[model samples]
Target: MSKKPVKKQDPETTGHSWDGIEEFNNPLPRWWLWTLYACIIWGIGYSIAYPAWPLINGATRGVLGYSTRAEVAEDIAYFKAANADLREELVAADLSEVANNPELLHFANANGRAVFATWCSQCHGSGAAGAVGFPNLLDNDWLWGGEIEEINETVTVGVRNETNDDARYSEMPAFGDILEEEEIAQVTEFVLSLSDDDVDQTMALAGATVFADNCAACHGEEGLGDKSQGAPNLADAIWLYGGDRETIMQTVTNSRFGVMPAWNARLSESDIRAVAIYVHGLGGGE
Candidate 1:
């Protein structure tokens, strides 16, 4: 018997055609269709179980009650609980006692650095070096005393702040109104001489009498500054405003009155102590 050739079957069409090309009416595979349906069902189930829809006032609260904010709050609570003991000890202990304990000191310094970056870096530079008007914490110069107790007091009460009754207060008279331009120039030269900067000896000599009569009550006779009066030392090269002749003239003529806010009302007692320790350890504290 001879082998017969197999006949080819024609594929079905959609009864539509364009320019002699016919459209095929092919059915999708059953497995692929089922998979697509399964995905749709899963998406619907997820929408019902969790927050999905948005309303005018807020978002949907699904049956599962899942919330990102609640989870974050729980994490914060856990962290605070874990560090409660150390935080409590830091709050209760004296600043010196905190410094004596190596572990506590380390913790305070680390926290203080973070606090300084957040709160103080705006005025004092990130390095605590300070700017033109701000006082540098890294040097030995201090308008107020630099001891831990003193630093704490200054930070708590602040300088020239009206809100705090115990704030460090001082007033520099604007000599532009009191004295003539010639007298102001004489005093500027005298201020420069205190720092051992080269100046006209004759002018400085004349200003020495003027200084003794007017400025010595606040600035010591030697220009070493009186911490009690919050007067800055004129003898030191460190100038809060500037060391140049023009700047000195300006200071003498107009005077300088800078203000620092009291931190006691803004920060907790523990936070104030920590910052004091951090500032004191910056190689300047007495």
Candidate 2:
């Protein structure tokens, strides 16, 4: 049998050329053209059905009202609802006695770690060994009280924050304006002498008098610090900002005002209690 002869059409080209290479004016394949059209139609449909257009404040809520955040919220709500009974029991139970109940202790430890990792880990590290400005939760050196009740209250209300009405509040006088530079330096020396074995004996002696007159009212005469006034113990080697002579001088001059957010505004009562229990048991609490 004889095969039919193939037709040879002249090649088409656009007016564009680069050296000897001519631009072929070829049409896209039929399947490829159809796929492109389908994609365009799908994109339009998707935009209409879901949030796509950007607005001044936020994205447009599409006709379907599909929101990833909303879905996530719903999922969270479902899980929260599932744990409602345990949470209610936790909230009702006294935090001091939380460890007595194995179920409650187990639940608190498990959930508290999760909550701490999510919220507390940013400031306090994942291991709860805080950064320069942040206090280490693992240590016994707490600015505020370290009892289970105290921890719960601190976590709930926070320290030096404006949001919570019952927040732990204290103000260290900016000695830069109040005292002379030499006085500030002397007091800083005395403060250093509390923890550091090597200190200027003469300057520290002079600072003893200055500390009794100005700082003793809050920091105490012995430099052990007043927990009632939220004053940190300077007698110990654990320093919040730093233990260096330069850092001590700066602290004495300017004063440190660290702010912590009130978890009560963001977290549930049970969650706060759980975290408090978790922190208290971390070999730090009194």
Candidate 3:
């Protein structure tokens, strides 16, 4: 066999050891060094092109002078242009006229339906069947009024709020303070009897006396609610508060007041009209 020589190791790190292991200093990879340099150059270019510098008044206007708000406005303008005819048709047509015109009605209803879902659906249900304190928009019985113009007014100016100047306002006094429990019970029975013909005639007769004295001034002798007073007709099955005996008792004890929010500030005129039309189309269009 021929003899072979062993290669010698470098001596600068010969004495350095970590549990008998030695370390070597290596230069960074060429690709990594270039990548770092490229990042620094890209940052400088980006800062120059965009509004990166902050001043006392605002940010600097870059060479492009582009703005996010301007871009948004341009986008909105484009969308409006594309849908101009539909918007115009809705704006020009009276809500009742729109209902008669199938195409315009469709356009208005679609937009109005969407807005109602966003704003009004929370109080008035998705189906427009209102809750305990809210009147059902789907029903013909209207407290404030159900005409398209009236609905539009309600939409523009909400009820019982300082912000709404012409807000619908009415209040029924709490009879609990004035009337005895027996008297309240009699009134509750009377209110229910107005709807049900099958009610106990004897009890109803007795309740009628109480109704004549306490309720006839607001709710007519026939139980036809006074719109001017915002008193709902007791003869109808549609109860704003509720129809149950317990709920009716509660209403008689302590009157209820419902509120509808103003959509004028939150929505455009066209949008408010659209919702009124859609709600009218829901079956309460008067």
Candidate 4:
């Protein structure tokens, strides 16, 4: 049998053509088209099953009533439930006992660190190194005693806070108005001598008399501060303000009164105890 020649069929093209190029009108591949259709269906199903549409007051309550907020609440509830016993034990345990139990100590430290970072990092540095006019937690120096109970007490009832009646309160008399400028300078040199810093021998000798008359009652005769009076030890290099001559002069002339907020009303009892432990364990607690 003789074979006939096959004819070539031209592909359909749009009317527009540019520079010998033409656009072919081709149908999408079956697989690709089906995939796109499936995606659209999935999107519609999702819109119906979850919160997707926005309304006037709030969002839509989808068929499944799924909510991100509800999910988060559930997760929070689960977390609290898991940690409830441990937290209760921490709350019930004595402040001293917290450190004795390994698990309790670990939990308290972690929570206390988080709490410190959130609440205390602003005044105390992120590392709790402290700043000018702020007491450093890393050192053994403490205006109040550094015992765990004392620390807890100080934290509960802060220094110079007005809200708490039993707050640790102390005031340095502003000697700028009380004494002559020369007298202030003399006392500054005397204070500097307490730390064995180089100072004017004659003026410090004279200032000793002035210190005995005015400052000895609060700051001991040796300048070893009284914890009962909340007076800072002047014999050490750890100065809350500055240790320089000028700074000492300013302190003597104007006096420094700093305030720390009472956390008793602000934080839970367990939280306060935890922070006290955390601060005490920072290599400074007595």
The top-ranked prediction according to lDDT is 2
> What's the CA RMSD for each of the models?
6.7, 3.6, 5.9, 5.7
lDDT score at residue 145, model 2, on the 0-100 scale: 84
Per-residue accuracy of model 1 over 1-286 as CA lDDT, tens digit each? 9989888766799999999999888889999999999999999998899999999999888899999989999996897688677778988897877778998899788777877888888998999999999989888788888888898899899999999999989989999999889888898889899987589999999999888888998998989999878898999889999999999999989999999999998987777888888988888868
In candidate 2, position 269 carries an lDDT of 92
TM-scores, each model vs. reference: 0.75, 0.85, 0.70, 0.76
TM-score (C-alpha) between model 4 and the true structure: 0.76
Candidate with more favorable, higher TM-score: 2 or 3: 2
lDDT (Cα, tens digit) per residue for candidate 3, span 146-230: 9888888878898876777778888888899888898888777777787777666676788889899988998899999898777
User: Model 2, 187-234: lDDT tens per residue?
Assistant: 888888998879998999899888988899898889999888999888
Which is superior by lDDT, 2 or 3? 2
Q: List, residue by residue over 39-107, the lDDT tens digit for candidate 4.
A: 999999999999999999998888999889999999978977887888899888888777789999998
- The whole-model C-alpha lDDT of candidate 1 against the native structure comes to 0.88
Clashes of each: 0, 0, 0, 0
Estimate candidate 4's RMSD in Å.
Answer: 5.7
Cα deviation at 32, candidate 2, in Å, is 2.7
Which segments of candidate 4 are over 4 A away from where they belong? 1-77
lDDT of 4: 0.89
- Which is the better candidate, 1 or 3, if ranked by TM-score? 1
User: Could you tell me the lDDT of residue 236 within candidate 2?
Assistant: 90
Looking at model 1, residue 166 earns an lDDT score of 93
Full-model lDDT for every candidate = 0.88, 0.90, 0.82, 0.89
